[model samples]
Target: MSFQQLVECATHGQTRASYVCHHLLQSGQDGSMRPVNWVRDEDEHVNAWCDECEEYLQSHGAEWNDKTEAFAKIRMICENCFETLKATNPTKELT
Candidate 1:
């Protein structure tokens, strides 16, 4: 689908812009990825990306002293992007 169509489709329900951002961020990780486990309080399952995205970021400017460090960086970067998108598009407030 076109980018606009993707946006339109994603915005049609209770889904928030942050959710969209998360998907986009993870899209680069892999298209066919899925969560391996579920949480009791959350509606959707929590998941991690394949090694591709992690390796991609590591090859770039991202630094990691250990495996946990890499994971922390990934979470920080994703949250930063999500918040930036949210701040710039107040109309698309995530409720």
Candidate 2:
């Protein structure tokens, strides 16, 4: 939620912070990942998720709750890696 704390990454070293879905934090790409939702907090990257979680969220009223939160399994990540995931993943149109 907040990026006030910094982390040390082997590849990225110390960098800005972000939160992402567990699936989006995976090591390899299966070409199924996408940037479904993202919010920028001033300069912080905030959070992002994939299409699957987006659909789940929509079905669950598109808000954080007990089940949705448990389903998402979101976790902390570095902005650098977040950028990489965003670049490799496409955006899904919700309509």
Candidate 3:
């Protein structure tokens, strides 16, 4: 079994920790939940974003810089919630 670190989430109780951009945590255009696109980070955390953000990333040569980081409001969520998002929303290949 893959064991991840657990932390107390006010909503999900004790759960694994995961991170994503604030955009992925919010509703997309027209208030619809959109797929979360994962960006390859280190093994310690999950870096996910929405399509627009993904596009912005690619336009910048897939590099994180001041411009990209400007709108990227990262947030922490329970792993359970992350799994829910991963299942409910369509996914894009990790880059």
Output the number of the TM-score-best candidate: 2
Candidate 1's C-alpha runs over 4 A off are 1-12, 19-50, 63-95
lDDT value for candidate 2? 0.72
lDDT of 1 by residue, 1-95 (tens): 22211112232433221223133355445544422111111423122332443455467664434653445333313333443333433222112
Which of candidates 2 and 3 is the stronger one according to TM-score? 2
For model 2, the stretches where C-alpha displacement exceeds 4 angstroms are: 1-3, 27-32, 92-95
Question: Which residue runs of candidate 3 sit more than 4 Å off their true CA positions?
Answer: 1-7, 28-31
Estimate, for each residue in 1-95, the C-alpha lDDT of model 3 and write its tens digit. 45565668887899767767777777632456777887544555566887888788889877778888776776777777777777777887675
* Of 2 and 3, the candidate ranking higher by lDDT: 3
In candidate 2, position 66 carries an lDDT of 86
C-alpha lDDT of all candidate models, in order:
0.33, 0.72, 0.73
Stronger candidate by TM-score (1 vs 2): 2
Candidate with best lDDT: 3
TM-scores, one per candidate: 0.24, 0.76, 0.73
Superposed Cα deviation of residue 21, candidate 3 (Å): 1.3
Residue 75 of model 1 has an lDDT of 35
- Flag clash pairs in model 2: none
Error of 3 at 25 (Å): 1.0
Angstrom error of the Cα, residue 9, model 3: value is 1.3
> What's the lDDT of the predicted structure labeled candidate 3?
0.73
